[model samples]
Target: MERKKLTLLQTVFTAGVFSAVSFWYGFMFGRESARKELGGLIEDLRRGTAGSEPTPRSS
Candidate 1:
C-alpha cells in the first residue's frame, strides 16, 4: 500500500536526521575539550616563564 511506503520513508528520514545531529554534538564536545586542555597548557608555560625571570636592580 502507498501508506506503508510513506511510513517507511518517514522513518528512514527521521533516523538520518537524528544521526547527523548526534554526530555534530559529539564533534563539538571533543573540540571544546581540546581547546580547554590547550589553554591550560599555555597558561602553565606562562607561569613557569614568569617564575624563572630575574629581577632588575636599580642604582
Candidate 2:
C-alpha cells in the first residue's frame, strides 16, 4: 500500500510539473508571437502603409 501511494504521488507530481512547463512554454511563445505581430503593425503604421489596405467590415 505504501509503495502504491508513493507511485501515485510521483506520477501526479510529474504530470503537474509537465503541465506547468508546457503552459509556460505556450504562454511565452504566444507572447513573442504577439510582440512580433504588433511590432510589424507599428512599423507599418509609422510608414503610413497601415491604412493603404481596406479593412473588411464585419456585419
Candidate 3:
C-alpha cells in the first residue's frame, strides 16, 4: 500500500537527519573543548614569559 511506503520513507528520513545532527553536535563540542585547552596553554605561556623577564627602565 501507498501508506506503508510513505511510513517507511518517513522513518528513513528521520533516522538520517538524526544521525547528521548528532555528528555535527559532536564535532562542535570537540572543537570548543580544544579551543579552551589551547587558550589556557597560551595564557600560561604568556604568564611564564612575563614572570621570567627583567623589569627596569629607570634613568
RMSD of each: 10.6, 4.9, 10.0
Number of the candidate with higher TM-score, 2 or 3 = 2
Cα deviation at 7, candidate 3, in Å, is 0.8
TM-score of each: 0.74, 0.87, 0.71
Top-scoring candidate (lDDT): 2
Q: In terms of TM-score, which candidate is strongest?
A: 2
Question: Model 3, which residues run further than 4 Å from truth?
Answer: 49-59
Q: Write the per-residue lDDT of candidate 2 for residues 13-53, one digit (tens) a residue.
A: 99999999999999999998888777777877888888688
lDDT to native, each model: 0.80, 0.84, 0.80
Question: Model 1 compared with the native: what TM-score?
Answer: 0.74
**Clash count, candidate 3:** 0
Candidate 3 — worst ten consecutive residues by lDDT sum?
Answer: 50-59
Name the TM-score of candidate 2. Answer: 0.87
Predictions ranked by TM-score, top down? 2, 1, 3
Clash count for candidate 2 is: 0
